[model samples]
Each structure stands twice: as C-alpha cells, then as structure tokens.
Target: MQSMEGSNRTLVVTEFIFLGFSGVHRGQSFLFLLFLAIYLFTLVGNGVIFTLIQLDSRLHSPMYFFLSHLAFIDICYSSVTIPKILVNFLRQRHTISYNQCIAQMFFLMIFSATQCALLAAMAYDRYAAICQPLRYAHLMSRSVCVSLATASWTCGLLASTIHTVLSTNLAFCGANRIHHIFCDAPPLLQIACSDTYVNEMALHVASVFVSLGTFLLVVVSYIFILSAILRIRSNTGRHKAFSTCAAHLVVVIIYFGMANVNYNRPSAGYSLEVDTLISTLYCIIIPMLNPLIYSLRNKEVKEALRKVLGGLKKDSGLPQ
Candidate 1:
C-alpha cells in the first residue's frame, strides 16, 4: 500500500499506531467519556453560535463577524481529530494511515493559524471601536472586513502548505508509532527517518512568528484600547465602554494563555502528559467554551436568538 510515490517503506509497516490516551495508566474509560462530552459540547455550542450570527443582522459588525468565523474554524478544527480519537477509545486501538496522518496535520495547522489571525483581527477591531470611536464604522467597513477575512484564510493556507510539503518530504522507515492522539507536526516530525533539520527549522520559524506576532499585536491593540477607555471622565461611560470588550478580553487571555504554555516551551524538553493536557485545552476545551462565552454572555446575540426562535415557533404552528 504505497500511498505516496517512491515510498518503499510500506514494505516495513502498513499503518502507524497512534499512542493516544492509552499511555495513561488508569482511568482510560473515564477519560474517554470526558472527551466525548467535550466533543458534543463543541459541536452544539459552535454550531448554535454560527447559526445565530448568520441569522442575526445585529451581529453583522466586524467583532461578531470574526467571531462567527472563529466558531466555524473551531468546529472544523475539533472535528478533524476528536471523532477519530473517540472511536479509538471505543475500540481500544489507535492507528492512522500514512495519508490520513498528513491530512490531519494539514487541517490542524490550517485552522490553528487561521484562529491566530482571526484573534489578531478581532483585537484590531476592538481597538478601532474603542480608541477611534469616531471612525469605527469607517475603519471596519464591509470591504475592510472582507479583506481581513480573506487575508486570514490566505495566511493559514500558506503556512499549512509549507509545513505539509516539508513534512511529506521526510522518510519514515523505522518504528511507525506516533505518541499523540492526532498527527501533529511535532510528533510526526520526530518519527521521520530522514533529516528533519529543515522541517524543524520551518516549524520553529513559523511557530515563533505566528505566536509572537499575534501576541504582540493583541497586547498593543489592547494597550491603546485601555488608554482610550481610561480617558473617559464619566464613570458610567467608562463602565459601559469596558463592558463591550469584557468577553473579548476573557477569550484573548484564555486562548493565548494556553497557546503560550503549549508552544513556547523548548522543543527538546517536554513531558508527553503535559503536552497531551495542553493539547486538550486549545483543541477541545477552548473551542467548546468560545461560542458559549461570546454568545450567551452577550445581550445582542440573546435578543436576536429570542426573536428568531419566536418566529420559528409561530411559523411551525401556522404551517402544520
């Protein structure tokens, strides 16, 4: 089963074993059910948020616009790997094909990079709304929002293309055991039989640029936003202004906190268990909570949902 060209390595192994939560000594069944619940929440939460944003004209602004996009990416991101993991947990064996592995890694990188870009764009949106309230609409006009979203998707695709190309270039002739739930760049790179120096360099450079660049942009944007907020003399005015960004602030902290903890570590030194837990945060848990925190906590979305649900109920009664 030579999936790729010149892949005589298939003579050695047919499929690679995914050493998932199986490495955990005890509580395997408990962990499986835990992850299952998280996956379900992710689907419903993100799904509802996306639907609400699309249906509600009130959420057509850049902030909610980018948020809807984030929820979509998160839904795709979690689906790319979690369902397979859940299946493996059920069957007691975790293995993925060579082709499937590459596909998973590619999609993961694409969504991961896209999420970073979206978050950075959201920061800039808040900055404009708060610091340049006079020009909020002008700054985040329909054309401008479309441009930003396009750029985010383009950057994500380009980054994933680079990594996928580099990853597939390497040979895996030895033990085909991947010690992670999904086919991540790091673990797959480690398993390559050929020289991975180039791949590692690409990975490090991309990771550093995305992580640091996005972090810096978010911080700087918020700094200016805070400065603008503090300038308001009226306490009520200040409180009202801050309330608009409170949910965004929470999301930024949670997302970046876990990202920094997971990716900023030294590549050579890290525990597998620690990596697994961190992976759970950014991949499964964060995505599940994002839609809830952003939508359920906000008045606009709730009002819109109420109207839509009422309309739906009326239509259902009238029709049948």
Candidate 2:
C-alpha cells in the first residue's frame, strides 16, 4: 500500500476526487435541482443588483458603489464552485484534476478574502454615514471609494498568494481523496505529505485576519451605527437609519456566522460531511442569499430597478 506521506521516492497523487453531496446518498437528482435553482437565483439576483447600481444615477453614491462591487464579487465567488458542483451532480462524477483543484482553491480564497475586506469597508461607510453624517460624502468620495476597493482586492490577492504558495510547497503524495465538495484549505492540508505544521500555522494566521479581525471591525462599526440610530428623535428617522443598515446587517450576520462557524472553531474532530454542508452555506447559500437581502429589502434598490426596467420597456416600444 502506498503510504499517505509523499516521499521523494514515490509519486504523489496527481489529482483528487471530490466526494460531493454523494455522501448524502440517494436523491442526487433532487440535490442537483436544488443547487441548480440556487445557482440560477444567485446569477439573476446579483446581476440585477449590479446592473441597477450601475445604471441608476441616483445610485451613484459610495454606498451603492460598494454594494455593486460586493454583488459582483458574490457572482464571481459563486460561479467558481457552483458550476463544477452542478456538473458533477448532473454527470454523477465529482472528480477534479490537480490543476483544476489548485485553480478552484485560488479563486475561492481570492473572492472569500476580498469579501471579508469589502465587508469591513462597507462597515466604515456605514460608520461615516451614520456616525459622521456631515462628512459622509467627503470621506467616501470617488477617490476614496476607489482606493478602498483597490485595497480590498489587493488584500485578497496577497492572502491567496501566500496560501497558494504554501499549499504548493506541501506535496500531496498519496490519498488523493479530497473528502469534500471543493478544494478547501483544511481538507487539502490534511492530505499533504510534508510536515503541515507550517501550512496549518499559515491557515490559522490568515483565518484570524480574515475572520475575527474583519468581524470585530464590523461589530464596532455597527455598534456606533446603532447608537446613532437610537439618538434619532423621530420614528421616521429611526426607520430610515435602520433601513440603511438592515441589508448590510443581514449580510454581515450570514457571512460572519458561516465564517466563524467554519474557520474560527477547531477544524479537528469535525466530520468532512459537516464541513461540506457548512462550506455549501458559505460558498453557495450565502452568495445566493446576498442579492435577495440587499435588493428585495432595499427600497432604493427597488426603485432603481423599477426605473431601469421602465426605461427598458420604453426603449423597446419606441422602435422596431
């Protein structure tokens, strides 16, 4: 039997088999349809928000600008993995090539980390708008928004680079089974032949930054935002203030909840099956839910969408 460790004397497994929802047994078709629906909704929901934000001049503010970018990231994040899972469900095979596995992991890390930073940026936006309303416009000006977005992306790239380089250094000499639906970090590290203490250390360090650090920043931002809302004298003022943050609050809850559950806790002793389900929530379900939370709950977004659709209808009727 080949040892789990990849010695220089032996060749490591060149590929990995994704044991997707196959663990659930039976109803593969049902699960396929379910995820297919989720994927489709993710596409349309995020797409609508992105388009509405771009087209509506009223939505050109910094808050909507950041929301548009967040929607775009959600689209990319969900696309990277859901399509593969969908294909696997349809074909009854959940295998991925080693190179594909690496690519998946890279994009997943990039988008996931980017979202963490973007959430923090959004928190600051709320803090400025609510806590320092006088300078919200000046603080979140076009140049500042651009810089924040650029930094968010740069952080994601840097984090992904470190993880990918470290992951590549550790050889997966055998036991090609990935034991999950995607090329997640912990599961992949488990199969590495080299001493993975370094890899685990890096993973924990990055998780700390991306998970707890961002969560704390958001919590602080919201604390001030809530205090500001409480100080408002009028009912309409309170409602408006809460409305401005409701979508973001829901998103933060969903995102940080999944992140804390998955990364903040000890990965030890957890079943791969549980990991897969939780991964699906963060990777699939949250992306699917974000657009709905933001678009449906937001009256400004709804109005923008209505105007955009009305314009399209008018344009379609004007000429043949």
lDDT of 2 by residue, 1-320 (tens): 24344443666666788865766668888988998999899999999999888888999988888898899999999899988887887775678877788889999999989999999999999999999989988999999999999999998999888988888887776677777788877788877778899878888888888777888999999999999999999999999888888888889998989987866557563677787888889899999898878877888889988787788889889632
Report backbone clashes per prediction: 0, 1
Q: For model 2, state the Cα shift of residue 258 in Å.
A: 0.2
Candidate 1 on 1-320: residue-level lDDT in tens? 33444635244345678765767656767878898898889998888888988988888889989988999998999999888888777666678888888899899989988888888999999999989889989999999999999988888899899999998887786568876778878887767778999988887787777767887899999999899989999999999888888888898899888877765667673667777778888788899889778876789988888888889989889541
In candidate 2 the C-alpha lDDT for residue 156 amounts to 91
lDDT of each: 0.83, 0.85
TM-score each candidate. Answer: 0.91, 0.93
Off by over 4 Å in 2: 1-8, 318-320
lDDT of 1: 0.83
Model 1 segments more than 4 A misplaced: 1-14, 24-28, 317-320
